[model samples]
Target: MKNLKKKLGLALAVTLSTVTFATAYSTTAEPTTAATSENVNENTIRNDEPTSDRINQFKDIAMYYYWHGGDIQQAEKDIFKGITLKGKYDVVENAFKEATLLDPYDLDLKLSLASTQIIQKKTPEALQTYKQILNLDPNHFNANLLYGVYSKVNGDNSSYKSSISNLKQIDAKKTNEYLQKLETTETILDENLNTSAPADLPQKDHAIVILGYALAEDGSMREPLIERLKAGLAIAKQYPNSKIIVTGGVPKQGITEADAMSNWLISQGIEKDRIILENKSTDTVENGLFSTAILDKEGIKDVTLVTSASHMRRALTVFKEASDFYNKMNGNNIDRNFTNVVYLDYPSLEEAHKVSKDEILVIYRDLIRTSGIWQYPGLQR
Candidate 1:
């Protein structure tokens, strides 16, 4: 849950957490007429971008490493089956450097590198990547939006203002709309993060919303998820009268995350009648939307969201957006915000507070999708 979710989010906050993702983009330049096939083959492993076929092959290798949190050795062993010309990259950063060197003009790849750098606490390097991204394409939508948010969060008003100007000029309607929603989400995030998970919550309209993690292939709970469940159990006992909602639909070996979570809670002495199961969602976005719909039907208003600290921000933001959407649809005056959250620090709490660049990017990305800006299924970039 903790760093695992964030690490997964680093790829595409809104994509397959444990699945491979190779976006259909070719960054390789066409071979020059004067260059021989031998020269091209030699240069493919060097700085020049390879042919489209070669880039696709590289993607299968690189994304598997990313999916496994940069376990390059395993990626090479599994994806390539004992072949990678770049040799052993002991660090994830080196893998990123290798990818960028091979496909220097890929904006999405650069963003991924910047995100990894930011997560690794290489702020100056990440910032330089952002500069390089802007240089590559001045009007890149995601680049400007994220750069703006990064600048604002880091107290660089100059960059933030400059970004805002660029965004407004780029697409005033869409950018302004997203910016407005961003303000609302930021307020919710700041207020909730400052406040601790309550010792007691009102029972009349409150529910402990526990966002679920995927189960092991054999349907057993992983350590991170077990930690989250432990935290949720504590919260449930504290607010014994409140309802509990476990949300996740991804199943492993025929066992859904919600079903396994509910079963565990039942085994731990929680009544089945008290726990509401949202077992149809495949990802966080669906968790928010489907869970909010269930809450609406049950007449629940206040919610205390429970998840890992790495996932808390995105969950809170997306849930808030979904809640607002549902409230507007139902014409209810109740403000349904995930303002109260309990986060399990999987590795440590200190690391959870440091939001990665990918998480920051996806908060808005998911919010916009929850806002109905995009109708597509998976995240594009």
Candidate 2:
């Protein structure tokens, strides 16, 4: 019986060691068929879901793309498509809410969602989102910067001050830099708002700047382009000695708007030497930034900014802001003015009515850009 007991104990020990070895092998091995089958089942469910379910699935897909796959642009497009298809602010809010749950630490996701909320006029929701971001990461640079701008636009002076204070504490260099530009913008905006009309043209020695519009597909001068060039020519004729600055860069066919404008102006008997073509700018902000650099280099401080009446507000604001930034950076006190705007009439009243929202948003966006946030690449102009 003692021998039998010893044999049984030996058998139990061998069985236990084998079981342990098998468990270790299972744990260290590559994923098993069960895991693969589970993934397949998930894919099957996703494929079989209804259209709404498929659409809602984008939240998870976007998160995966952003975090796991490291494809930010694709993730952004996926989220954007979800919002676009829904066409409702609440739906967008919900999509962001679900995404945030998946990646609670994602600052970019929070900022994008907040921006969307602001665009949708969901101020309270946006404010909450901003608060959440600040709470998560108190020193988040973009969050603080954009929150300040948005607060100012929303007329929440208290929140704006708080955000600015927080910015100063977290990043004093950026705060001071942005403050200077913000002050310049505020001064210009106040002056602009108080004045009803464009300033009268300076009598002498001031440059004439014609903001270019779109050229035809074949690089031909179109109506508005022709109108703007004509208006600039009239101003040039008035101040024959003053240089003409033609600003635009978007190309058609093979020629830029500035090139088209220059050709048209030369064709209409304007001297080529008197025309300064700024063919590097792509948008109004670039137009202002690039044109001002040339103006400063040429010692042209006073300018008669000419564009369509609908565009005058934004164009003038951007020009003034750019000029202010240029002057501040160069330590030169130049008196930049947009006193004279030769209005190129819009095609019709309907087109004119399409101006206000776009104009205001551009002005606000450029002001933020001028404040040293979201700066484009290049010479920091």
Work out candidate 1's RMSD over C-alphas.
Answer: 9.0
C-alpha local distance difference test of each model:
0.66, 0.62
- For residues 1-381, could you state the per-residue lDDT of candidate 2 as single tens digits? 222212121221232333332222121112211222323433211334343333334333322222223222332343343433333444445555655665677666676567557656666777788789899898987678777777777678898899999999998997897787667655544332211223455656578888988777688877777776777777787677788899999887789999988888888899899889999987788888899999998888678877766666667778887887898899989987666454536665445445443345456666766545543111122
Cα displacement (angstroms), candidate 2, residue 272, comes to 1.1
Clashes (candidate 2):
1
lDDT of 1 at 196: 47
- Candidate 1 whole-model C-alpha lDDT, 0 to 1: 0.66
Regions of candidate 1 where Cα sits further than 4 Å from its true position: 1-50, 69-71, 74-106, 118-121, 192-206, 213-243, 249-256, 279-286, 293-300, 308-314, 324-334, 339-381
**Sequence-dependent TM-score of model 1:** 0.62
Q: Which regions of candidate 2 are displaced past 4 Å?
A: 1-132, 171-180, 190-205, 216-222, 344-358, 375-381
What are the per-residue Cα lDDT tens digits for candidate 1 across 1-381?
A: 222222222232222334433332222333322323433333122323234433443443344443344444444443333455343322344545655766798776677666656545555676778789999899987678767766765668799889989999999987887787889877645543422457546767888888898788798988767877888888788788889999888778788999999999999999999999999997788999999998998888788888877778888888888887887787887776454555546455556666665667567556766776332112222
